[model samples]
Target chain A: MAFLKLESLRKAYGEFVAVKECSLSIGEGEFVCLLGPSGCGKTTTLQMIAGFVEPTEGRIILNGADITRLGPSKRGLGIVFQSYALFPHMTVAANVAFGLEMRAIAKRERRERVAHMLDLVRLDGFADRYPRQLSGGQRQRVALARALVIEPSVLLLDEPMGALDALLREEMQIELRALQKRLGITTIMVTHDQVEAMSLADRVVLLNNGSVEQVAEPFAMYEHPSGRFASTFLGKSNVLAGDVSGASVLVGDQELPADLAGMSGAVDYIIRPEKITFAAAGGLVRGQVTARVFLGDRWLYQLDTPVGPMQVIDTNVGLPKAVEGDAVGLVWAAENARVVARGAAS
Target chain B: MSRTPIALHIFHWLFVLFMVAPLAVVVLVSFTDKGYISFPFDGASLRWFQAIWNQKSFIDSFWLSLALGATAATLAVVLAVPAAMAIAWHRFPARDLALALLMSPLMLPAIVLGIAILRLLSHLGMTGSLAGLVAAHMVVVLPYVLRLVIAAAAGYDHALSQAARSLGASAWAAFRRIELPQLVPGIAGGWIIAFVTSFDELTMSIFVSSAGTTTLPVRMYNYIANTIDPLLAAISTVLIALTLVLMIVLDRLFGLDRILGGKA
Candidate 1:
């Protein structure tokens, strides 16, 4: 049985729906990330699971018990916010001890647990310091320690690294993932950053317009997106709009064979930028280089072809440079492109 | 930046001088040796302060005003914080109307409110009581508390509260652990303003105060009306000092910048 399950959850503000009939099940010790752009209902889904937002419909079950109407405190879930949410008035020790105090734990045990948690976050000596005294990364660690000190059944992180600087964010992401792994806690994190989601999540739940677009492992989702939205959202992809013809797609005068069968009529094909390569002599299609951007290790060439503007990332290994307005040959293996019907873009 | 014109500079200084002149005179006269009010020069002594200390009624009224001001300010915060939170957090159908009603007391004429309270208390047979004075003072102080706290709560990072809730804090726990602490500066600012308003209140106190319940401001008004002496200056000086001390304490606790919403 799954440790936590959300079934047909919906949240609406007036006539605007934030989360619509979303359902997911998380296994014990699973680290799931709800990844989406802002207003995509990722945070709303996390809030609903946390019991802060009452769902307009459906149920939240934990270990097969319905907890749809339970308050946040009764749900036994640990949450870390984007801003850390550490109490400014309290010391680090006090903040970590708050949950224990609320549960009426013994004072000695509370102190012991707080000490242990602070140590776990590498903040042992800073227990007496207030949140204002700590650095941003330290404060975030303290917040994590505070939440985990309670020993909740599930841990939720709402863009927990959003407040940190770029360097600290990367460092904390690694540290947080390690900590979560060490604790063996069932965790759900909401993030807009694709890199964070890809690195941390056991499974990434891609949401678009309040609905699940795809849910899969990071690599699988990147390699095989269910639709145009998922392919473009998870990473950068050059999408070509065309109509399917028998086993091929007609692009102006050029006809390219469709790699996937069952693709009919008007469809969109998603090809990763890196998947396109330069044809040395002759290849699938011919194009003119409209733009070239030097990206350190690789050259990003924007090709203007009959299909449209196609982006290709090429390694700069003594390859002849293609300048702007230069004619070039474009090529891609038929098996690399994933074609989907136009209606699935929504 | 270019220098201001000489004429504008003089006007600005004169405006500032006008504001400080009355307060300066009160402080200066508090140390006067002569029995009557005088300007510029007077033999300086602590005789007026000594005389103020000797007056049993002044001392009693001073303590009474302190008690009343503290009680009313505390009551105002107790009533205002949750009201401000509710107004800041939700957009209920009647929220606007509710906020307007809560703030109406600030615009209402003090004499009118005092009279209304007097009539109500008389009907309830509780006139001339401390309860009556506290009730009236609370009416005047509440809006100031509410306005500051509402501004504070509105400016607070609401995501912080959501984070707390996601971290397994109950609604009450999130409020106590996350939201309430951020509101301290605002609540303190509100408390200071409320206390000052209640302490300096004369028009309202005049209606509610009886022989045994006369506040410091009411007593001071009667004293000044009957006699012009350095003793009244000493009392005024003391009031000014008290206000400054409370403001400084608030500044020390939560920086005066917070009072102005941390702009500077």
Candidate 2:
């Protein structure tokens, strides 16, 4: 059974539709991420679920109860804002104890629970410090502890790691994921960073123009994006416009094998950079390397091909397989390429 | 860092001296033994300071002014906090107009406001009442309080309130525990500013005050009009000291630089 359900939710501010009939059912203890670029309604959808923004139409059911009209205070959900939003005037212990205090929990239990939460977040000895005195990562941990202390049914995080540096963000991501799983709490996080979503979430919901484009496991969504927007937004893709005919896509007179399933007309042949391999000869498409960028663990090669410009990523084991101005053929399995209908969402 | 030029530094000192000269002269004249307002003291004496204790009206007015300023400032802050929150947090129709109307007293000339308020109070039979005086002072000090509170509220992280609410805090609880505590610097600064402004106000108090409800500044003004003596200078010196103490207190509690620089 679904633990939470957003049923045909739509939010419109006059003529502008912020979230257009987005629907999803999340399983118990599921970690879902609403992933998209800015203004893609990902944040709006998260806000609706958090009960901060009321939907113009539709219902939100939580734990088999219709909570569509419930106010945020009664939602019983934990939330960590992008800015952390830790109470600057309160000590770390007091900040975490706030939720329990609001619930009218007794003083001794509040203290014990708050202490335990501080330990859980590894902020045990820093309980008396104020938010301003703590570093960025420490403050984030305080926010997380504060939210989780209430033992809420679901935890909502809005760009939780956006404020942290890259290294700290990665560290926090692992810690947050472990904490969520250990607690077995349902989690919904909103992020524009695809890498963060891919690494952190159990399921990634790709949204565009106020609608869900695709919702699948991170690997599945990345491997088989449903449309043009999903294919490009999640990661870089070398999309070649081609004509579909006889189980093949013809790009600038260069035929490439594809699974069109008898569908005809214009289509976009999408292939990830890492999936394409360099060949000396007899490959799908012949291309000349235009530029090569060394990315520590990988070498990203830009190439000019018969169809259009293509990007290919070769793993950095020893030396680069190809250099700038080198002529090479690019090869990829037909199953690895995604054939999306053209002109739907470019 | 670049050094300030000697010419500019001299000009700055001259400007400071120009501002402090009159106050220094008042302090110096307060110690004079002469009966009149003569500059360059004959000899130092504390008799004029002793004379302030003999004047019952000055003492009474001083206490009355303290009560009036404290009461008026508290009332202004109580009203302004909610008013500022509404203006800063909501998008109601006429929000800007409401702010303008509330802050309109700052734009109007004080003497004009005094006359207008005097006319209205007399009609309401509250012309000489303490309530009327406090009402008038609240009008004068509310804008200062509201401006600071609004700035603080504007800079406030609204997400904090939402976070509190989502963590099972009721709206009132969130406001009381989270929002109000964060706004302490603004509220404290506004209250202090309002108190000082109301205490030092002269023009509006002159028109609105009765003999029974006279303020310290009005009493001082009346004494100056009747007799130009060193006793007046002594009272001014005492006020300067009190004001200096209040400034120190304000700075210690909430850094004056930060509050005045509008960071809160």
lDDT of 1 by residue, A209-310 (tens): 998889999999999888888888888898877788878887666777658577688888778889887775676778888888897898988888877888
TM-score of 1: 0.91
lDDT minimum window of 10 residues, candidate 1 chain A: A251-260
- Who wins the lDDT comparison? 2
Q: Per-residue error at A203 for model 2, in Å?
A: 0.8
- Local accuracy of candidate 2 as per-residue lDDT tens digits, B140-225: 99999998888888889999999889888888998899888777667777887899899999999999999899999999998889
- The alpha-carbon lDDT assigned to residue A218 of candidate 2 equals 95
Which residue ranges in model 1 land beyond 4 Å of their true spot? B1-16, B30-50, B163-178, B237-264
Superposed on the true chain A, the predicted chain A of model 2 yields a TM-score of: 0.98
Per residue, candidate 1 scores C-alpha lDDT tens digits across B1-264 of 998899999999999999999999889979989978887654888898888878999999999999999999999999999999999988789999999998998888989988999999999999999999999999899999999898888878776776566555667878877788788777888887899889999997899999999999899899889998889999888878987897798689767776746221
Residue A321 local lDDT, model 1: 66
Q: DockQ for all models, in order?
A: 0.52, 0.89
Summed backbone clashes in each candidate are 2, 0
Candidate 1 residue pairs that clash:
A79-B166, A79-B167
Q: Please state the error at residue A20 of candidate 1 in Å.
A: 1.8
DockQ for candidate 2: 0.89
